[model samples]
Target: MNVMIFLLLSIICIGLIFIIHKYFGKEELYFLAIIYAIVALMMSFKTIKIFGIDINASIIFDSGIIFILYYFIRKYKYNESKKLMLSILICMLITSMFLITTSIMIPSLYDEFNFSYQNMVLDNLPTIIIYPLSLLITMSLSSYCFRQLKEEEDYRLIKTILTIIGITFIEVLIFIYFSYAFMIGFKKALIISLNSYLAKVILMIIFTIFLNIIFKVKKVKE
Candidate 1:
């Protein structure tokens, strides 16, 4: 029953992302939204246990927060920090702020040992801050490598970024709905988290590719 439900939910999530990319794709971050969805799905399991809350719902909320963060950093350009609004540097700043805040708010969630406050401040605090920043760094690195190799003014960049953004929004909705609609426990959270990671990333990647093709057509008309 749980597996069936997950499969169904995965399909619905995929469809929703597709529609969002189609309609809201002013540029191409719509496709990149899927990457955010993929990351959320990956982290949803162990993290669901973090605050003793619904893992899926937390994923949705965190992703929403990231969106808002991304919006502000992009809109304000945060002290001329980025050449393009969607530059990798800006994305890092947005993602880092949220991750750092999340770390501060809910530290020591699943720690089996009682580390002292002093130790937490010196050791754990850096761990909390560094790990997430590493992820953002890796993503930024990937973007940089691509940018350096490709034509700087190419349109593909926009499409790719938009796809990632679309992935982010849809995953947020999915986790929010599932956490509310279903009663899930630790063991199930574990299993579903794995399923979500697998399904969401693979599906989003495929859908994002399709969205790119669609946008290519639209660009021609314009």
Candidate 2:
């Protein structure tokens, strides 16, 4: 019954994303939605029980999705070479394999750790902050690398940066929704959802400014 509800929720979210993609005409976001759906499906099948709260392993996998998006942006915006793309793909594959192996080998490792709800939530607070920060770093790194190889015209650069910001915004919402919706009731989930969006939006604004500065430097160079 739980699995069925999860699957249904996944389908509904994916459908909404597709609709947004269609209306917004962002092919990259469409792909992002699809990747998110894949992660959600994986969560439906397996979850880690921490402090009697079920957390999806797929949250870790969501980080991989951000990396994948970085690759996509690199390829499209900078015409990243096939060899480098292949190398990235291989690295992601190997990392995923290692995670899967570790999960299988030590499924019950955390089960022995007694955790109070307050302690568990406190422990997870850092992760909640770290995940979004890591995502920002990924976006920044991807943009920096691509800009080193090829600098777009000023207008194109702005468009690219905006797209990255928009995608980051969506990514934050998706991550927060998946992480909390199952753990909290609707009211608390709504509060977390708002806070999460605000946090990520601030991060996005900061990063977007940083990107703009880099683009200005590139323009000055050219």
Candidate 3:
């Protein structure tokens, strides 16, 4: 969460990505690490108030990361590989540490309200439960889309970017339904859900496009 600590972790994560790429010949993990680190950095700088809950912006990056992991596991046929599974687990654990640390330590705009991870109580337990469940559900749903897109050769880059956005939007919806609506009643949650969905759709679209451009430039250099 601290800038110095985040920087140190970023260097270590990037180094690990290079090692994985070099040893296993999977460069996709490098890109994944880059996206994760970049998003983590961006998220450290801001928080948003949504549905009376203060959430970190890095939550927006969850589905994209999940999509990348799902894409690679399917692409490499690594579902049965223990080593690959271990590596993926390691990546997720590291990312979770970052997310947990940042989310717990950073004071949200509504710091006076005790409703998040740091102040976990009976009132917020359902939200905490739904958060990780929604992540798994989002990734599972995203797997179908990624599987379909991974096979197509035509406009694959564009397809991949769009898929990421679509899945992220789906995550927003799920988060709203399972988490937000339960926290607040359904009637009030509807409008907030719509606004959140649209906001995430636009943000992920722009983020995906920027990442696509970076990939293009990297490919050209290679």
Output the number of the lDDT-best candidate: 3
Off by over 4 Å in 2: 1-78, 81-93, 106-165, 184-186, 218-222
**Cα error, candidate 3, residue 116 (Å):** 8.7
Clashes of each: 24, 0, 0
Q: Which runs in model 3 stand beyond 4 Å of their true positions?
A: 1-58, 70-122, 217-222
TM-score attained by model 1: 0.34
TM-scores across all candidates?
0.34, 0.38, 0.55
lDDT of 2 at 136: 45
Of the pair 1 and 3, which is ahead by TM-score?
Answer: 3
Please write out the lDDT profile of model 3 over residues 1-222, one tens digit for every residue: 344543354345334433443444456564564466345434523445654544444554553455345536544664523343344445545555565565556476776763544543334444445554565566566656767866788997678767776776776667655565676688665765666666566555654554444333322212
RMSD per model, one decimal: 12.1, 15.3, 8.5
At residue 141, candidate 3 shows an lDDT of 64
Q: Mark the regions of model 1 whose C-alpha exceeds 4 Å error after superposition.
A: 1-17, 25-131, 148-208, 217-222
lDDT of 1 by residue, 1-222 (tens): 644654455444444434443554323343344355334433433333322223342233233224322332323334322333244434535554664454455447686543443343333333234334433443444334334423445566465455455444444334432442344455664555554444444444554454445434432211
Clashing pairs in 2: none
Between prediction 1 and prediction 3, the one with superior lDDT is 3
lDDT of each: 0.40, 0.44, 0.53
Poorest 10 consecutive residues of model 1 by lDDT?
49-58
